[model samples]
Target: MSHSEQTIEREIVSKGLTAPRLTPTSIDEAIKDEHYWVAPGRRLTVCALTLRNGFIVTGESAATSSENFDEDLGRKIARDNAREKIWQLEGYLLRQRLHDA
Candidate 1:
């Protein structure tokens, strides 16, 4: 992995978020070629968390800039998005549980 990639990975882990694996799809490859200035493949980042009740939540983000794309930033954004969603769900579930009780 590149230095930037490693740094991003560490940052994700440090934040207690799982590092997303970069898996490029066919469309991502095509887009990369069409946009030569951009990286040659997709650096899609996704985050997922399993709640104590076996519920799963996820968030995803991708590199936006063709030039000077920062994997670290992308990962952070994705993880944050995921974390927000998780909290929202948690709040809703807790409210429902309390209402039922």
Candidate 2:
């Protein structure tokens, strides 16, 4: 997490609104499986994550120049993008759960 994000999370935790309820560790654990691959015949990396509840989310990373394409870097970027989406989705789910409570 970025310094700013850590600060914000500390503030929220201090207020007891939403902190321990939806944590980064929990988010990481919520994923049941993960997969990554480069697009055939292209310099694009695709990441797929399957949530514990069987929901799937995908993210992609592309190289501007084929000459500079690095498979390892592309996979990292793509997987990070996919995990970021999971954060957003899980945040929404937590909000809904709070509302319904």
Query: Which lDDT tens digits does candidate 1 get at residues 1-101?
Result: 33554686678668887433331221122221110111355566665645555555566777664454566775666655655555455556556777797
**Residue-wise C-alpha lDDT for candidate 2, range 24-76, written one tens digit per residue:** 67778989999988887568999999999999998899999888889999998
Candidate that would win on lDDT: 2
TM-score for candidate 1: 0.50
Candidate 2: misplaced stretches above 4 Å?
A: 1-20
Error of 1 at 33 (Å): 34
Candidate 1 Cα deviation (angstroms), residue 75: 1.6
Considering only N, C-alpha and C atoms within 3 Å, which residue pairs clash in candidate 2? none
- 74: Cα error in model 2, Å: 0.4
TM-score, every prediction: 0.50, 0.79
